[model samples]
Structure formats: structure tokens, C-alpha cells
Target: MEALTLYQLNRRIAELVTNSSTQNVWVTAELSDVAVRGGHCYMELLQKDPDTGATVAKARAAIWANVFSRLRSDFYIATGQDFATGLKVMVRASVSMHPVYGMSLVINAVNPEYTMGDLLRRRKEMLARLKAEGILDMNRSLCWNEPPLRIAIVSAEGAAGYGDFMNQLNGNQLGLRFTTRLFPAIMQGERTAQSV
Candidate 1:
């Protein structure tokens, strides 16, 4: 048996990866982590087992500054969202291996439609589940008493919408008095769910 140093083995792997047919392949993966540094986007891509919800495959990936600058804005324009953790993305990438960094994918392009489609699918699934549980129409089924004099507003303070709502309610032509309370809440971004 012959022995090889760690660098020699890594070099061989790098060569194999570079020459492989996987170059310029399209892959669908979930972004477990995303970051931008020095204008380059770095990400960790993964796949999970549908039934168990456990990660089954994972890889490191990156988009160089030149490509990332355009792709980032394009993706945001198409998807109405930024590249963030937990987003499923379809990307065109080349598999690369380095002696020090092991393996990573060099992404050159991204398909924003893939993420949008996935979001729609997930929303549909959630709605279906709520329907099955008989909660989907719960709000519609509720009966209002006396046209609801008390308004509980959930919105961020100083928001334009909040001001508009208050103005509309206060300027009502009927001159009816109503009690209103503002419950400040975050309306968008990552912490919105928890904050709201």
C-alpha cells in the first residue's frame, strides 16, 4: 500500500472535481446560512428529509462579487425578498475543491422563480392544512356585534398606514365615537413574525 500526504490527497480531489462533469450544473437547494462580505455572497446549501425534517445533504457555496452584485438585486426584484437563511434557491454553479477549503460550489447565476414558486407552494400547503383543520374560515364564520366600536390596531408606530387608518376613523362623516388602541408591532422583515 502507498501512503500520500494530506495535501497530495486534497490536490488529487481538487483535480477530480475540476475535471468532473458537474461543472456548470443546476442545483435546487435550501440556504441554511447566507452572508455577504467584501461584496461576495457566501452560503451554506442543504437538503432535508421531507418526512423527518432532518438535513440530508449540505454544501458550501459562494457567488463572487461581480456576479453577486447583479444577481442579488435581480433576485430581490423578482422575489420581493433578499437572499436570506432558509430560502430555497435554484442556482447554476460549478463544483470546485481546494486544498485548504475542501469543496464548494461557485454560483454564477440564480433562478428567483424557483424561490417564489416554493413560497407559493408552501402557502398553499399551509392553507390546505388550515382548511383541513376547519380553521381556515374561522374568521369569516365569526359574527360581529353592533358593528364593533372598539378597534384594536396592530401596526408599527409612526407608520404611514397607521396614520391613514387613524385619520379615516377619526374623520368619519357619521360623527360616531370609537375607542382605538395601538398595539405597536413590526410589520416586516425577519423578526416580524415574533414581534407581531
Candidate 2:
């Protein structure tokens, strides 16, 4: 028997993956924690069963730094909400596998509007369900003043929402002096939960 050369092994792997399957899919999922590491941003995209409130499926995805930076800015400008935790997103991605990382999705682009719409729909559904269960008004029955003075905010370091939140909190109009402590989190994918 003859041993395969490194180049031959790599070529075979590439061919196998490329020809195994090809699909252009639109997936709607909740964006949890997002983290950028080593020039790559990793995140988890998940969806839950509407009636049961149980997760249906989840996947690991990544955006290379170049793509992430542009997409991040575009998403924020298009939608008031930052592309961070608690945001819903619709992604056009390719299914890929890494030699070491196993299965992953390489996100090509995003539809912020679609994501926002999905989020709103999900929120409405959740609210309706809670209302029917007699728990929707539980928190609304209580009221409290906004915090004064120091604010400890936890968010991604350069996330657009974080910046906006800080700006509003420190703007001169408020005339309220305060210090901000930002505890950065992974913000998007599977690591997001772990960081929190």
C-alpha cells in the first residue's frame, strides 16, 4: 500500500467538502454573545420551537475580521440596534468545515431589516404567550427611578450600541456626572454565553 502525500490529502478533503453539498439558505436566528478573536468573530445562531419554547437547532459561525468589520458597521447603520446579543439576524452563509474546528458557517452577508423584523415578531409572540399566562404585567406593575451617578455597563468594547448608550448616558444635556465601567463580553456566538 502507498501512503498519501500531504498535498494529496488536502486536495481530497477539499474536493469532498466542495462536492458534498451546496446550498443557498436564509436562516433566521437569535444573536446571542458575539466575540472577536484572532481576527475572526465567532457566534452562535439559534432558533426555538414557537409553541414549546425549546431550541430547535443551533450552529457555530464565523466572520473573518475584514468581513466582520464592514458587516458590523453596515448592520448598525441600517438598524438602530447593534448586531450584538438579543438581536435577531438573517444570514446568507456557506456551510464549511475546518480541519480542526469541525463544522462552521462562513457568513457572507446579512439582512438587518429581516433580522429586526424577526426579532419583533418573536418578541410579540413571547409577549402574547406571557399575557395569556398572566405574567406579562408582572414587571410593569413596579416602577423605579433610573440609576444616578456611576454606571457599570457590560458590553462589547467597540460595539456600536455600547458607544451610543454611553453617549446618551454622558451627554451634556443630562448634566449628570457619572463614571462608566464596561465589562466586555464575547457578545455573539456560543462563547457569548460562556463569557456572561
Candidate 3:
């Protein structure tokens, strides 16, 4: 048997990676983590098993500063939303391997409308499922009563929305009174869905 050092193995892998795939291959996955450092955008992409809710695969991906800037703007223009965590995006990327970074995808393009369509389909499916289960009309199903004066707030404490809401409610000129308490939570990015 022959032995190879880490550098030798990585070099071989990098070579294999370079020759194995073509540029501009479209891939779809959920963004697990996203960060920007020194103008470069880096992210972790994850694919999950829908039925079992388990992660199927994960990959490191990057968008160069220049490419990220244009893609982010274009995505926002198409979707009216930020390109942040928890989005399932379709990206055109070149598969690459490095001696230090292992395998990664170099992203060059994004299809924001793909995710928008996916989200819309999921929402419609959820609504249909809820309706078929006789639970879709939750507000109408519940017994009627006047809305409660007391409210429990759940949001990140420093969020502008929270500040504005508190100010509007507390400083109402009509002098409407209510009891309110805020439960602070991470309001954005990957943690927000779990926070809520």
C-alpha cells in the first residue's frame, strides 16, 4: 500500500475537483449560516430530508465581494427581501476544492425568483393542509370575545419595530391603556424562526 501526506491528498482532490465539474452549475439549498468578512460573503448551505427533518448534506459556499454586491441588489429587486439566512436559494456556482478549505462552491449568480416560487408553493400547501385538517380558520373557529387589553411582546429588544410599537402604544394621544411586556428574542437571521 502507498501512503500520501495531507498536502498530497488535498492537491489530488483539488485537481479532481477542478476537472470534475463545469462552471455555472445551478444548485439549490437552504442557507444555514451566512457571513460577510472583508467584503467577501461566505455561507453554509444545507439540504434536509423533508419527511424526517434531518440534514441530508452540507456545503461551504462563497460569493466574491463584487459578485455578492450585484447579486444581493438583484435579488432584492426581484424578491423585495434581503438575501439572509434561512432562504432556500438557487445559485449558479463552480465546484472547487482547496488544500486548506476542502471543498466549496464559488457562487456567481442567484435566482431569487426560484426561492420566491418555492416559498409561495410551500405557503399554499400549508394553507391547504391546515384547511383540510379543519384548523385553517383558527380565528373564526375560536369563541368570540373582545380583544384583550394586555399583550405579551416577543421580539429582539433593540429592534426598530419593537421600539416603534412600544412608542406608538405607550404614547397614543387617545390615551388608550394596556398592559404589555416584551420577551426579547433574536430577531433576524438563522435564529429568528426558532426564537419565535
Candidate 4:
């Protein structure tokens, strides 16, 4: 057997990934966090064991700021949900890997509807579990209709999703006034729960 050089190993892996198939896939997951640095937005997406609450799988993902900015605007216009930590999202991505990063998904597009479906599914599951435990309506319903005029919102700094949220609120015709405090949170991955 012959020893494979580092260059040879990388080339082989790249070729295998590139040649296997070309697919445009839509993936659904929870957005754990988003960060912007060096003209790119880095994201972490994850899923966990429903019963044990342990992470099952995770991926590092990214969007160039230009694409992210446009998507962020379009997403908000299409859906009222703010793209933030704890919100579910569906992304159309390309499978890719870097020598240093190992594996990542380069998000080319997003489908808010798909993400919403995932959220609804999770919501239903939680509702069912609560019903089984006879605690579905245990807590008094809290109305967030009149959110504190001074708000501490947790979101990704400079993220298009966050930007959209702010823009909508700021542009309200009623001149609704509020002071916003921004707190950063990881929007995806196992650590997302803790970050929030």
C-alpha cells in the first residue's frame, strides 16, 4: 500500500464530493445562531433528540452577506416571523467541505414556508405531550400584544432577519414608538439553547 500525501487526500475527497451528484436540497432545522464577520454570515443549524434533548446532528453553514441581506429582506416580507435564535428555518444549500472546516453547507436560498412547517410540527408535538401530561393549559396565557415599549431583543447583529424585524417596526404607520435593546444569541446548534 502507498501512503497518500495531504494534497492527494484533499484532492481525492473533493473529487468524490463534486462528482457524486448535483442536488438542490431544502433542509429544515432550528437556527441556533448567526454571526457576520469578514463579509460572510456564519450560521449553525441543528436538530436534537425529541425525548432526551440531545443533539442528533449539526452542520456549519454560511451565506455571503450580499445574499444574506437580500434573503433576509425577502423572508420577512414573505413571513412575519423574525429570523432569530429559536426560530426554525429551511435552507436550500449545496453540500461542500473545506480542508480546515471539514464540512459545511453553503446556503444558496431559503424557504420560509418550509421552515414554518417544521416549527408547526414541533409545536404540535409539544402540545400533544402537554396534553398527555394534563398540563396543556396550565399556565395563564400571557399576552405579548403590548410588548414593553423598551425591549431587549436577542438576535444576530447585522443579520438580515434582524434588520427586517427592525425595519418593519420602525416603519409602522402608527408611529409606534419603542426603544430596542439588541442582545446577540447563537441561532443554531446544541449551544443555541444556552446562548438564548
Clash count per candidate: 0, 8, 0, 8
lDDT of 3 by residue, 133-174 (tens): 988898786784665679999986765568879998989887
* Winner of 2 and 3 under TM-score: 3
Q: Point out where model 1 deviates above 4 Å.
A: 134-196
Candidate 4: tens digits of C-alpha lDDT, residues 128-149? 9999998887655656666567
Q: Residue pairs in steric clash, candidate 1?
A: none
Candidate 3's C-alpha runs over 4 A off are 20-22, 125-193
Please give the lDDT score at residue 93 for candidate 1: 94
Off by over 4 Å in 2: 1-17, 20-24, 122-162, 174-196
Q: What is the lDDT of every predicted structure here?
A: 0.86, 0.75, 0.83, 0.75
TM-score of 1: 0.68
Span of 10 residues, lowest total lDDT, candidate 3: 15-24
List TM-score per model, in order. 0.68, 0.62, 0.70, 0.61
Report the C-alpha lDDT of model 2 over 1-196, residue by residue, as the tens digit.
9999766676666567654353446667876556688877788877877699577888888888989888878887777655675567888887775555666678878998896786678779988999999998997787759745777887778877788798887786958888878888866544667886
